[model samples]
Target: MSELIHESVLDIFCKYATLRREEMTLETSLLAAGMDSLDAVEILFALEERFDITIPNPASVTEATVGDVVNLVSKLVAEKEASPSA
Candidate 1:
């Protein structure tokens, strides 16, 4: 699942970002790299379709990094999996 999330992130990033995969850093600014608001929304939408989870804050989209996003996704998926379905 984490691999899938990471791939999905890179896929979306390739669609709009000029930065190479190697250029991405934990502090690399997605905005500075040209991830506009609409692009971010598109990324969120793609993530939703690719993964079966929902991120509450499209705005608070973490600035950690691609790796950070992967970690965040992993954490969220695990949390959701751990919770009992009411």
Candidate 2:
């Protein structure tokens, strides 16, 4: 599951930020990868769509690293999966 989430998040970074896969690591900061505020928002939108979840506060995601986003999305995915009403 983490692998899938990682792959998807990497793809989003690649598409929106124009970052190369070789330039990323778990601890790599998105901002350092040339992502600005707008890029973060765009990636958040992509993530929400990809994961089928809603992010109420996109601003908070701007400072996250690749692993952070992966972990966050993974958590959200887990919660949604565990919840019958989600």
Candidate 3:
């Protein structure tokens, strides 16, 4: 599940980043990869829609590495799966 989340998040990032998917790594910084503030918001929204989960904080996205976003999405996915409402 985490791997799937990682791939999906990477795919979303690729849509907004100037760098190619092959050039990105878990430690790659989103901003350093050519993502601006608007890209951050768009990525967050994409993640939310793809995973059907809410990101409680938006600030984290701007300064995050690829791994950070992957981990966050994984956690949110797990929470949603565990929730009774879900």
**What ranges in model 2 sit over 4 Å off?**
58-60
The list of candidate 3 runs beyond 4 A from truth reads: none
In model 2, which residue pairs have backbone atoms overlapping below 3 Å? Answer: none
Instruction: Give TM per candidate.
Output: 0.73, 0.90, 0.94
Worst 10 residues of 1 by lDDT: 58-67
Clashes found in each candidate (C-alpha, N, C closer than 3 A): 0, 0, 0
Q: Which tens-of-lDDT digit does each residue in 1-86 have in candidate 2? A: 99999999999999766568988898988887778888888888999999998766755565789999999899999999999896
Least accurate 10 contiguous residues by lDDT in model 2: 54-63
Candidate 3 per-residue lDDT over residues 1-86, each given as its tens digit? 99999899988999999999999999999988899998999988999999999999676566799999998899999999999998
How well does candidate 1 match the true structure, expressed as C-alpha RMSD? Answer: 2.7
Among the numbered candidates, top TM-score falls to: 3
- Which regions of candidate 1 fall more than 4 Å away from where they truly are? 1-4, 60-64
Alpha-carbon lDDT of model 2: 0.86
What's the C-alpha lDDT at position 49 in model 2?
96
lDDT value for model 1 = 0.70
